[model samples]
Target: MVGVEVKGTTRLLGLIGDPIAQAKTPSVINPIFASRGADIACVPLQVPAADLQKIWAGLKATSNLIGFGITLPHKQMAIDLCDSLDPVAARVGAVNLVRRERDGSFRGYQFDGRGFVRGLQAKRITIKNRDVLMIGAGGAAVAMAFALIEAGAKSITVSNRTLEKAEALASVINGDFGRLVAKAGSPRPQTGQLIINATSLGLNETDALPLDPGLLHPGMTLAEVIAQPEITPLLSQAQARGIEIHSGIHMIKGQVDLIADHICELWS
Candidate 1:
């Protein structure tokens, strides 16, 4: 038997967000694509919320552009740009993955929620019947909460700097998931089995945690979805506290595989 040679021009995939310079997707996914013999190049696109639609619309006609992984403000905005939404994406109300079809129509999907669930499982973190205390109410926060519930979390308590935002996220989850253990108050949800820092609070060198470190116990597992600085401030605290820490790198890895598969399925 002889090996068949495979080769192609580099196809471009990108991540679009306001503070895109902080994104690690290009570094993470590019190597994976290269290892798989995929001639693809990934870039971080610093696209403001106001220009998301314009930038995406322009990509519709670009033949060399393969796909995009959305972030921040655009994750929710992408729902409006897609020709269709996958069921998970619809329920989460966020679209992190966009697949450009042969006809140039992009259908939106969300892999973050699903990826988080799967990544946790890969790490032997059981979601079923676990009490979850989720912090932050932004796109990533919302997705993590929903993913935990869908994976059969026993209870969930959400907290954010803005109580109203946390409550609003709870409303959407309650409407969709039918009775999650959501609340807003002081002391930060009493620290459940899992403590998730979904906020960007730990992204900066000087950012303090939304909750006091005394609230986090060694028995609980601390997970943060912030990719930059790899070892985030929250994870640093968790380490000193003797709590188990899962880095944002795992979530990024999960998305890389799914994103690659989505592009190959849709474009190849």
Candidate 2:
């Protein structure tokens, strides 16, 4: 750990989520602030979705609470609570970063999508002109697919338990990035260089891989968006077969940076 210049009066940032114990924000964001000589500390706040509005209102009233990193259910709710929203967040209809303005108003922005693209770049993965096979069409999945297309991915294939949900996300992506291939037919598509898992699958005892590991090839690189249970079952299976693996931790760090940038740009 690097030493940082901090006064007794330093401000704080935090993450708000229902199940925040497994989050990697503190581990990643705190070090980032320290290394950057910022007089700030990021913490984790476990707040359920039902209490989000109440908590957010109180947070806005507090002076020491510099900003917040929202997760899961809170992301969508934060958008509703914000006095203003960044265009990216508005388009995605979600907010993962929130900070108070000079007029005592709070604004929200979506950073996860930008972070996913940054994480891929940090790992030397190229989305431009690459065929992507994304598993899961959940919130994060939708955000990543949209971000990937914006980053110039040649084409994408989204797979989810419900084919219609996957098709919905694909439609949105196609609406922005040209023709996106949707695989809902009997035969699943097997051609893709990048395989990303944005599902909460393989995160707990009750969860399992969305698809079989036998389908993965060694040439394929996998990116999982689940951080808890660090080595998810999907990642474990991929490792067993020698497939390149990118952990959810990378995305956490990437999002932290994007949020920090937003804080400095808009708040500072």
Candidate 3:
């Protein structure tokens, strides 16, 4: 097996999330750095929700580090931790990428939505006028809801365990779009023409399905934001039922180039 050589002069990059073993960022991105002969390495940090703030300090103090990618719970919480945000991330209220400056201040950016849209487009999945049921009120969900609407999805229902969080996210999308294309609703599998699992529910075998599999019909297309276990339990169920399924890896694959370029710019 081949690997990038890490040495005293190698720069560092991190990907942080709970249950991070399922993440594909380091494997997907580190090779780009190697091919370009960049003295950089991306590593996964398995940080549960409770310890994010505790570790944020250590991340900031690492001089050899550029910044880290955020996922799951940290995506939203890291917004406050950032010294500034790209307007897209500010509007989405979640950050997927951060660049720590020489002064130790972190600037945040969100590319999840763009990547997701590009993924769907690349696969020729029709987004225009499709009613979407997005499960999750966290960072990735909020960003994708807006992207879906902007991509001409007929409407979107943001569903989450906490009803208020779902409602709040829908409200932001509607407010920003100046239309009622998004709203809070339960995760009823039959309601959406396109259903996306944006939560971290599929990271482990013990996690529950985001919705009732029995309700998934043949006409609907299902997608995800969880990159590992490409065939998540939900996707497996959907595929068994002959429903069109899209994997989470496509989302990362769609945007990895942007990520590599952003890091190269920062390094320069």
Best by lDDT: 3
153-227 per-residue lDDT for model 3 (tens digits): 999988999999999998898899898888899889664489999988888889999899898988899999988
Q: Once superposed on the true structure, which residue ranges of model 2 sit more than 4 Å away at CA?
A: 1-8, 178-189, 265-268
| Candidate 1 lDDT score relative to the true structure | 0.77
RMSD value for candidate 2? 2.8
C-alpha lDDT score of every prediction, in listed order? 0.77, 0.76, 0.89
Task: Specify the poorest-scoring 10-residue window by lDDT in model 3.
Answer: 184-193
Tens-digit lDDT track for model 1 on 12-95? 787888877678888877766767777677777889888877888788777788788888768877888889888878878888
The weakest ten consecutive residues by lDDT in model 2 span 180-189
> Which of 1 and 2 is ahead in lDDT?
1
Candidate 1 deviant stretches above 4 angstroms: 1-8, 185-192
- Per-residue lDDT of candidate 2, residues 83-180 (tens digit): 99888878777778887777777888777888888988999976888878888766677678778877877777887778888787778766655464
Off by over 4 Å in 3: none
Winning model by TM-score: 3
Could you give the C-alpha RMSD of every candidate to the true structure, in order shown? Answer: 3.9, 2.8, 1.5
Ranking by TM-score: 3, 1, 2
Provide the lowest-lDDT 10-residue window in model 1: 1-10
